[model samples]
Each structure stands twice: as structure tokens, then as C-alpha cells.
Target chain A: MLILHCPHCDRMVDETDLHPGGEAHLKRHGPEADAEAFENYLFMRENPKGVHFERWRHVYGCGKWFLAARNTATLEVYGTYPAQTHQPPQTIRDTITERQPGWAWGDFR
Target chain B: MSEPVSALRGRATSGSVQVSDMGLQGMISLRCDLSFGKLKALSKDLVGAPVPALREAQVRNDRAALWMSPDELLFLMPHTEVDDALSRIAKAMKDQHHLALDVSDARALLRVEGPFAREVIAKLAPVDLHPDVFGPGQVLRTRLGQIAAAFWMTDAQTFQVICFRSVAHYAFDLLEASAKAGPVGHFPRGT
Candidate 1:
């Protein structure tokens, strides 16, 4: 039931209007990578209770994919940005830090 | 060389509003960076209207340019003018990275007219249809019940909805049902 802003369309859209695309910012393991690395890349996921980053498609709106940073525990959406971005913008990380203090996710702080 | 027929063959429905198939309309799917300088000029030359701003439509008389996405626009004109429009676009943007195609036959256009037009569409799409929030010149690509559709206001009391021709009958029936479902009074009648 979350109403999230779509960075591409600049519209606040209903959750029903969006399609969740699982976790974001996963590193890829190519054909040369070890079995363990490939398995982790394919199936391993972080289930952090706070400050989760995920992909979402504006399936009903602009039909573009975007990334969202939100607090899973409180349903507070920190921000959303275009899918082309490799990392959450500095401002969103700063916002998360201001609330959670010293919080970091994988390689992003 | 052969006769072109619209989906549903120009069906019309009456309830609180007038819903009818707008018949075959010429639509061109143009995908390119909107900021390309020549795009604005060439589109104006082809459609008699400037390329629309985000979520807006640039329209003049029987022609309109509707913003479909960050890098896409759907141009509308008379059905007979499609081939010429495609050629003009090809010639104008030949040197640029662009994709232009005639989509006139791939979709159906429906018109809903009456004071309750907004409410009728609102009953289906998740868009906020308040007059101030959505009115003439604003185009929205959104879901209509179970289908993907785009719609825009031609005037305060008129709306034009475009959906895939494969779903034309379903879209028309949805609009008709919404129109007959009786107003929820979410928006005042005749506003």
C-alpha cells in the first residue's frame, strides 16, 4: 500500500501500479567465476530489516524501471532514482544515515 | 488498396455519457531523445504542433503530439496521412538515432464525452482525475482495468482513450459499464 514517487515520471504512484523486481545492486558472476560465486550471485539476498534497496517497474504509469531505498521495518521510503544509477545517490545515503546513524548496506554507506 | 476498418466497427454506447469508437486514427510511435534540437522543429512541421512537454500534449486542430515516456512521443493525425508522416520523419531524422513507425492500425481510439467523462475514466484508471489535477492537454499512460491504455482530455468534457486494438472491445465495454454504473459523486456532476 505504499505510495512511491517514480523518478522517471515524477509522479507519486500507488503500489498496485508498480511491480517489485526483488533486491537491487547485485554483482554478476560470469561464466569463468567459481561455483560458489555463481550460486551467491544467483540466489543469495540480503533480508535487512531496514534500509533496503529494491527495483520496481512503473508498470501502469511510465513503464520505466527505477530503484527505491526504503525502511522495510517502518515502510518509510527514503527516495527513488532511475535504474541507470549504479548506486543510491549521496543525498539518499545521507538521509538514511541521519535516521539510522552509521548505517551501511553492502558496499554503500 | 483495401478498405480499412476500425476495431468494433465504429461502435457507440450511451449512458450518462457518450462513448464511441473514434474509428481509425493515424498514430506514429516516435522514440528519440526529446532534447534533440531538430526533433522539436521537425515534429512541429509534420504535425503542426510542437513536441509536448512531459505528460503534456501539444495539439492543434486534428493533430496532437503526446508524450509517452522520457524518450517517446505518439503523434496523432488523420489516418490517411500516416505514410506521408512516416516518410517526412524518416527524411527529417535520418541522421539521428531514432525509431519511428506507423502504429495507426495497432490500436483503437475511443471517445468519451459528457460532464461525467472524468469520473467515468477515474472509475477505471488509478490516476487522480480531479479537474485541477487532470484536464485538457494532459496525457496519461496508465492501466484501465486489466489493460494498458493512454488517454487525454480533448476538452473539459471530452476524453480520447487509446488501447491496443486486440482489446478494443474490452476497453469499450469497460467504459460503457463505468458510465452506466452510476456516478459515485467523487467529482461533482457537470463541473
Candidate 2:
């Protein structure tokens, strides 16, 4: 089971108490959200290789929306900080944690 | 709601004040926003910090507990803190928007702790409650033995479950039956 530490609460949670969020949240761009645009928005993916951002919900607890840093190839988790920033930070994409995986992108306790 | 009041959703009576027991060891519920404008400040006052608070959840404070959701928090104060539990909690949210609800009247708590405690709970509760899956400090609002319940894992294989007080006696029957397989835990945490 996945145990996630809420950055806000600092408490560990099992997968049972959480709900999986949708694919990486693509920042919604105003003025470009037409009907056809909305459909494409819902059905598209940019499967990037490096640090990618996704939406996650702490259903059982805070129930607040947050951003999660993860790598698609390794299913590694970089960090799960709050989604306060309107835009995803680009600095993380180049980070490398020196752990078992040689970088900070593996499953965390 | 199509939900049926089972052994978990205990019945409420008119003459005697309604009550709820989780049929577990430690249990307490607090409903308070207390008119506190901001959640972070109110929480910091209740607990030392404002993190990991939710319904049915438990935060370890030696003997006291803290679980705050958007508005309310259900505390499982240790068995020793009952007498003055309310005051401390009140002081925490003294200047904030707080509502201290006397859960003893509407909720019932039942504890099952022993080697086979989990075994008996499995009969009624369907969720996989193994230690690894349901870790400590986790709270769940799930159904128990046909009754909806809020389950909090206080320790390994130890649980504090509570529901509305209306069906307290019915829960007693089910808990008593489960206890046959193992001994009951302690009474409510504090008082």
C-alpha cells in the first residue's frame, strides 16, 4: 500500500484513505477554452519524461487539492506539496535526489 | 438516504438521551467551528499545530487526540483526560469559532482488543483492516455490520468505532457476541 505524507498535516496516510486524482493537471488557459478546445483538453496527454505534475485528492482527510511531482517511467514520487502555485514550477524537472534510485524519485515512506 | 440503520447505526431513544458507541476502546467526537474565522489558527490552538485533522481521524497526543475536518473535530482524549477535556479544548479554541459538542449523548464507542479482535471485526466490517493496510492515525467513515460507522485505528489491531447512539443496545449485542472470541478493550479513552 502507498503511504503518503501530507505536507500540510505531516501525517502518513495509506492508499485506502485516499483517492486517485486525474491525469497531470494541464493548466487551464482562459480564452482558448472553446467547445472543441474543451474536448481536446479532456483527451490529451503530453507524457513527459522528467518531473511531471498531477492532481491528487486527500479524500479522507484535508480534502484539499494539491500538486504531486512524479515520473511516469519509474512511478517515482518527487514530492507532494500543496497546489497553491497557479503554475507548476519548472525547477523540479531537472532535480536529482541521491537515494537508492540515485535520484529523489522513488517510493517514499 | 437508502441506508438502513443496522447494528452499526444504533437507534436513538426519546426518554433516555440518544447515544453512540463505536464498540471499541477509545472514542470521542467534537463538533466545533466555534465561529473561528480561520481554520489554521483554531487548529493550532487545539493541537500544537494545524495539520492532520479530519472526521473520524485520530492524532496522537500521548493520551489526547486531535482530528479536525473543515469545521468539526472528533477527539479521542485518553482515558485520563475526560474530566477536564472540554475545558482544554475550549481554551484551545477560546477566541476562535468553536463548537464543543457533547458526543457522549449521541454517540456510542465500543472497543475490541485482543489477539482475535480483528478476526471478530472482519465478520461485520468488510474493509481489509490488516495493520499494514489500515495504519494508526487513520480514520474511516465506513459501514459496520449493516450500520454506518466512523472507524479510527488507535494502534496495531486496536480500534475505536463509533456511531449514532440510537442503536447502542443493538451494538452491545453485536459487540458482546464478538467479545466471545476475545476480551473487550477498555471503556472510552478518558471519561
Runs with alpha carbons beyond 4 Å of true place in candidate 2: A29-40, A48-51, A88-109, B1-65, B69-72, B75-108, B115-158, B163-191
The DockQ scores of all candidates, in the order shown, are 0.71, 0.11
Model 2, position A55: C-alpha lDDT score = 70
Q: Summarize candidate 1's per-residue lDDT along B121-141 as a digit string, tens digits.
A: 999998788887888888988
- The lDDT of model 1 is 0.90
For chain B alone, what TM-score does every candidate structure achieve against the true structure? 0.97, 0.57
lDDT, candidate 2, equals: 0.53
Across residues A1-109, which tens digit of lDDT does each residue of candidate 2 receive?
A: 5556565445555455567776555656455678767766676665566545677766655565666776666766766766676544545444434322344222321
Q: Can you write out model 2's per-residue Cα lDDT over B22-67, one digit (the tens) per residue?
A: 3322334555553445545544544444444443343555333445
Is model 1 an incorrect, acceptable, medium or high docking prediction?
Answer: medium
TM-score of each: 0.96, 0.48
In the range A1-109, model 1's lDDT, one tens digit per residue, is 7888898888888888899999989888988999999999999898898889999999877789999999999999999999999999999998999988987788888
For all predictions in the order shown, the interface RMSD in Å is 1.1, 5.1
